[model samples]
Target chain A: MSFEWPWQYNFPPFFTLQPNVDTRQKQLAAWCSLALSYCRHHKLYTLDVLEAQESPVFNNKKIERKLSMEAIQVVFEELRKKGNLEWLDKNKSRCLVMWRRPEEWGKLIYQWISKNGMVNSVFTLYELINGDDTEGEEFHGLEEWMLLRSLQALQTEGKAEVFSMDDGKGVKFF
Target chain B: MDRFSWSSGLLEINETLVIQQRGVRLYDGDDKAKLDVGAALLSTHRLIWRDVKNHECCLAMPLSQIIYFEEQAAGIGKSAKIIIYLHPTPANKEPGPYQHSKYSYIKLSFKEHGQIEFYRRLTEEMTQKRWESTPVSQPIPTGSATQTGKTRAVGIVGIERKIEERRKETDKNISEAFEDLSKLMVKAKEMVELSRSIANKIKDKQGDITEDETIRFKSYLLSMGIANPVTRETHGSGTHYHLQLAKQLGDMLQAPLEERGGMMALTEVYCLVNRARGMELLSPEDLLNACKMFESLKLPVRMRVFDSGVMVVQLQSHSEEEMIASALDSVTDKGSLTAEEFAKLLGLSVLLSKERLLLAEKMGHLCRDDSVEGLRFYPNLFE
Candidate 1:
């Protein structure tokens, strides 16, 4: 699916960090929502500084304007302050982009499980991520780290129980 | 003129007329004197009257001949009159209008203006009684010298005399206008108008007044044209003064502010205000205080101090939003602009232009690009 661009994406000044406090606040808010939607559209769970700069979300060649490394960092910092993003390292070169939180992923999975009458069925992590039965679901392409976090969210709610099997980790839905 | 003796019978050889007033009519008893609508001259020795159109027909009476004098305040549409009570005519009288008169006093009515000031000076000359005392050491060569000069002056000599007389009057007018502030206060209303017209006439015609004095005089009189300025004596030294002053400032600055985009520096206000006040000098503190009252008094203008301590007086209608809009429009019209470039484009000072750009930025209508090249602003597309 193609991601629709915000009108500000083509506006040159939108690529630079505004100097005034009020203007900068509005600019950062616009940037935060744009980054989240772009990530959700492409199912991007993580980002790195170099790769992020190369992303269409930050670089717009049509207008020949791109966010500087420092300005991009400022926008990410704003997103982190709002609790939508997390740094993966001390240097802030890499980050986790949680467009869909673990709780939301857990809710989607539980809805799918109860609808299919598989409330008490047990499933391996790989089956939930890549199984033929889950191929048509929103969580079908979930990464291992994201799958574990979703199951942990379900466990906190007492909707699922995770245990170690001989082959790998598995979750039994309540 | 005919009611009194010929003008020569009035003054001593060395004396000259001290002051002259125009459009005076003399009264003999209750009837108007036949010779009227003339100029009146005040000398230390006598009161002389000369027909304005016919300068040769002049009449004079010595100050010693007057017993006392008083002023008749003017009524509606009536000229101010000065009644001079005289002692009886001496046994030996010169030839003129009447052989004798029934009344002991004669009146001089100011048909146009300034009988009051003339009366005041007349009283002063009478009280001093200079004719009874020593002759003035620096004697003016008047009656006898002029008579001789007229006969001998020819060609270049005649032209020089004409220039000398015109220059003398022009010099006198300049001195009277620039004289002590206290003296100007007493006769300011009428005198300011009189001098401004005369000075302006002299200003336009360079060769009429002597070049040296005219050049020196023009500098001071360039802005000296106002009349009846509010003073401490007129509006007490209280808040009342500031109110009157603020009102006057509002009236005066309205036109100038409109011409200058509805804003001006406080220092410019001081110069413009003081120049319009003419002789009365205004101090900076008083000007600031008066300007401060503009808004409180609901005037059309108000004084403002900036964050960086710059002070300005601007029209009440001038608003921050308007300035920001204008700035944003200009920047967008040109893609982007720096403070200096905008200043040149809008004919505004760089500091004011910068402040306007900053205001636009603060309002989120524009954003700045500050770099090694310089600070420039572009329209805020992020909105």
Candidate 2:
């Protein structure tokens, strides 16, 4: 996308951390919005700090700009402070985006299965991902481990039941 | 020849001509006082013959003008005279009143009356440029590079090799000077680009910026202009002169200083001035001294030391009291102001935020609000 004022993108001060607290706060806010937009649009759940290829926030093509590690940390720290994200690993290299958290994802799955009347039906873990029953749900490309965990959470809440068949991987839902 | 004698000896110069202004002082050997010539039209000083003609033309006297010579029998003015000959001789040599031992005597004492007349004629020709009247600065039209019998300058036979050597030396010096200047110029251009891009970025994100932030941004912005200022290293023996050159650099910072309400820190000036000077940098002491000297002389600018002991160079025309009064009036009419809001009302500079508030408070122009959310500022408590 072309900026109306392309010179704004090329300005090197954009890369520097403003020492003034008020300006830095504003800068941080803008950065947060940019990061959220990227994560949501790309359907990305985790961001690798070391990987420059995947993170869209660092990619400023028109100006050939890239945010510093400190800037990236500041933005993520701000997001974490706001309870909108979490570091999946302690070193903070990998961050799990919680703008839409696992609990919310689980809730979405529950709603979809109930609407499709598949809450009482049986299916294998493989079939649930590859199954016709979940035809138009957010569950289609959902990670298998995440889907199991979410399903298990639903079971614990008494919203559904799971029964194992001869195959340990197979399960019947009720 | 008589004209030369009259101009060199009888031309009484005034006092103002000999006094050094803006550059190095080349003093007269005999006169501890200013060499008195005559009053000059350009200034109040004595007009030396050389200075009167803008230093391009000068009169020369023959050695016979020496009415009485001090014989160096044992050691009396002889050593000092010897120094004149040991040093680099003047390229266009002239015989002054005194004869020094080191310089070649040129067989003057042996050649009597007739030789003196010949010497006078030679001096007159060299001084008047009798041969230089020819306008042909181009190649001799001998049709080819290897052609012979081309007319050359007089007395330049064995001196031809010396002329070539001198030409090469001069050419080398000129090219080296230009090369250094060009390098500095290119560096200056790069610095400008760098600073521009930085300032542009800061400008783009101006919305969330606070007054203190704007102040800092301004400082950064000021420094951006001086990407390639001349420094001391670039002009080694001319640091003082270069310092003066840097003051001219401060002229460009005027608009930014004015916008920031008429004062900026020396640290800020230093960064900006050094950057602008390119490779020609003045030391911090030199910069300060230059500023102090400028102030002492009642230049348009002055150095303002705040109550906090922070030094800033600013235009004397800027009035802090007026700014505070105006800021007070605006804030009081509104009844109150947050520090952030107040900064917006007045263009806050890089001076300490607390100090600004403290000053306003002291002036009965502002009051503090330490509330649950955060510390803030409001209109003066008197209202």
Candidate 3:
């Protein structure tokens, strides 16, 4: 999918992290926004740091400028601080892109369940993620860890209960 | 050679009498009265009487005529006196019809007995010189002849003769010490004044000297080099000398900085200042330290290191915003600027120009475009 990049994306200096403190802050903010929107448009839930180095979002081939790993990590760190990203591993080699926050995703799932009249029904995690019935949904085939976290958020709100099933994990709406 | 070297307009020798004498009265046969209060200088050919009150009252006399030189003994309530006897007319010249029939003498009475010693030294110098050389004509006793012949010569011819005589007398008295080397020394002092006056004249004439002449004059002044260089010996120690060097560098940089539009690379300033200083050169480290001192002193010039690690000296008043605006003005129709083009416009080295462009990019005044042509800068249209 095509994404409209900001005018600054064409600017070579934008690819190089600015050394000045004030300029760096603005650069970080711009990078964070661009990365978030780029991931959202492509529906990419996880971004591999090493892979992003070669990706068009991090490297602008037209300008022949590429952001270093350190620069990418710094931009990701800013997104993490704003609750828009989470490191999947301790080394921060990969990150879970939270285009929508966990709480927002929990509310989305609740609205979907209520619309389909599935309140008080049980659904296995696998069926909820990849079942044919949920094929058209935004959360279908979502990462299991992110799905589990969203369900846990719903459980904290007393809207659902998660329990172990013989086949796999399952969640039941109250 | 004559007893005195006349190559110098006046007699070359100079000797000061040792005794401090004051308030001695000289009487010339009741017609001339003069005070001899200061030390007398004995030169090779003349006895020069210098007055303490007015140094211009320098009277010289030949050594041969002081025949009866004697110091009278002090008496009760009377000061000691020196008696100098001379021929009624100068012994070497024809006696004129109006010459005095009797002998003539000058008697000087001193206030202190110490002066008697000076008289003795004078007598000794006169006797020693008399034995060494033959007599020469005295140019008519100036005091006595002026008094006697004043009424006879009053016409234009006499006035011209007086001027000629005065010119000759002045030429004989005002010794030129180093006639050949003196012109340069005199010109050095006069050149500064002359340049200032010429500058004023140019100002009055309003562009009469032209830009080329002004530039030539500036180069000429720069070539003159520092007259009094501040070395370690001049300023005492290394640190103090460095501080003084820093000050001198700041002063020297003002002109070049103005010429370059308020900025110059550190290397260029180093070369120029060292050239101006001639023998005294500062090391690069010393120059850096000197620049650091400017911060504490609140000097108007400062040292700046760009992110690219290139250093330059610029005036504190120089604004990056203004530099960007000017650089933008020089951008080609393609809306890009290479370091070479920027350097040419800013009158800086390509390296320094690149550094400044990088700084401007950091400041968000411009954005970089790295292409096959090389790293170029364009105005930050994103802003």
Candidate 4:
């Protein structure tokens, strides 16, 4: 019989620390991982520690654990320390998630175009995604920011050209 | 010579006195001094004694010397008393009683005039623990010398027998206390009471105790050690060992942090350490000092301060691999693995693993995909 996993005992604050030094260190690491995982799973681009409820770290029920302001700061601090995340607002309510680093994204785009025999072909932004260009490929759901960064990188390397007209439309070519 | 005096209080030529509670000093034409008055020490007023170059010299007189001044018509600087004595010589060692056994220096005392309530209180405290004066030794009786020698020999034998008895008692007590300690945790109250009674015996017989005896007693009592060790109330030069006690308390909490992958909060550590110490609740200052001492030692673990001024203590070598391995092992039993699926896993919640995964992606250990669902990492296509 498939075991019923139950309601997944979602004590939210377990993801958060107890404002204690040692507990908080453990909590921060745990929360940062949870947050990263959540972001990666849902393809979330930005996270607001304030508004996010499904973020497991914000809920605490099993052992009545809770995250103090300091605990939240520590988790964010951990992310910032690793250079994988950034605060988006002055109040630090939101943070930009860098799922893959900018440089690696550049390298991926370079490799993808060369391998696909699209080096000498021109393609529209929509065609790159919804068109046949990236059908059945990993780049199908690539974020606009990642695509833009990859395109800019290719342009820098003289591997591609980007053109814009009076109507404010854009296209790319190898 | 009586250095300076205003009231009935006497001032010395080269001695420093803190106005525990003030009074006056009177000086005669022959450079004699006396004082009588009242001054409060808690006020903003401070009388710093100094040498000619204005260092910490004993020659500076107490502010009570101002008690010798007459009621002068208000002059600002002149109204205050500033008496300079000859530069005093430094002691062969730091000043303590019995430093100069031979020639006595001028001694100063204050006699209060008005509202000497504070002075009276001070005197009461000083006199509470009065010294018993024993007369200077006369001669030992010569007739009993031979008998006394025999008695002394017998007395030594008796003391040795007593010491043996005490040793067995201490050893038995220690072994019992530790017996309970070895068997998980027992009733803390019982342990404390056991220790307390033993401490009482140690205190009562301290006069007859030798160093070896005391050391043995302490070793046994270590099992029932201080329910409350040195506190701020009982801290002084003699209690540096209290730091070691506090450090041991910190050590007990190590297992809890270690279990959670070498990460813990500073405040939690403080609470756990203090709780383990039982009655030894350390002040915030003591806790901070302990943390700092640990930092200076450059232990394998470290204290961290976040951007939000939140402090935490974590391992310096905290490895993401350990966390990831634990997380992966917990989940690897299931066949399929996806980025979002892994993110939802508790094993992935550890900070080090998240960092490692990011690094692995950067170093070609993994690759990531940004889908409408979210961002996900998988085994690197590059690798």
Which one is best on DockQ? 1
- Tell me the tens digit of each residue's lDDT in model 4 across B257-371: 6665576667766676555454545676666666655555655556665444556666667664664554445333433234445545544333433444444444433444333
Question: Model 2, range B1-383, lDDT digits (tens) per residue?
Answer: 11121123222222122122111111223322122222211112111233332343333332222222221121433211100001233222323323233332211111112323333343443344322343223322211223345433324452575458568979998999899879977887787777778777777888767878878866765655653344455545454654565466456657657777676788887886776555455578777766776554556677777677878877778767765676677666765555566666665653533446556666655654443354555553223
In model 4, state the lDDT of residue B173: 91
Tens digits of lDDT, candidate 1, A39-123: 9889898999888998889988887777889999998998888877889999999999877778888999999999999999999
TM-score winner, 1 or 4: 1
Q: Residue A111 in model 3: shift from native, Å?
A: 2.2
Better of 3 and 4 by DockQ: 3
The window of 10 residues in a row where model 4 chain B has the poorest summed lDDT is: B135-144
Tens-digit lDDT track of model 2 for A20-129: 45545655676666666566656566778878333445655664556778777887899888766778888998887655455666678667767777776667777777
TM per candidate: 0.51, 0.32, 0.51, 0.30
TM-score of candidate 2 on Cα atoms, chains taken together: 0.32
Off by over 4 Å in 3: A83-95, A115-118, A126-136, B1-218, B224-251, B279-312, B319-321, B324-341, B361-383
The CAPRI quality class of candidate 2 comes to: incorrect
Q: What shift in Å separates residue B370 of candidate 2 from its native position after superposition?
A: 32
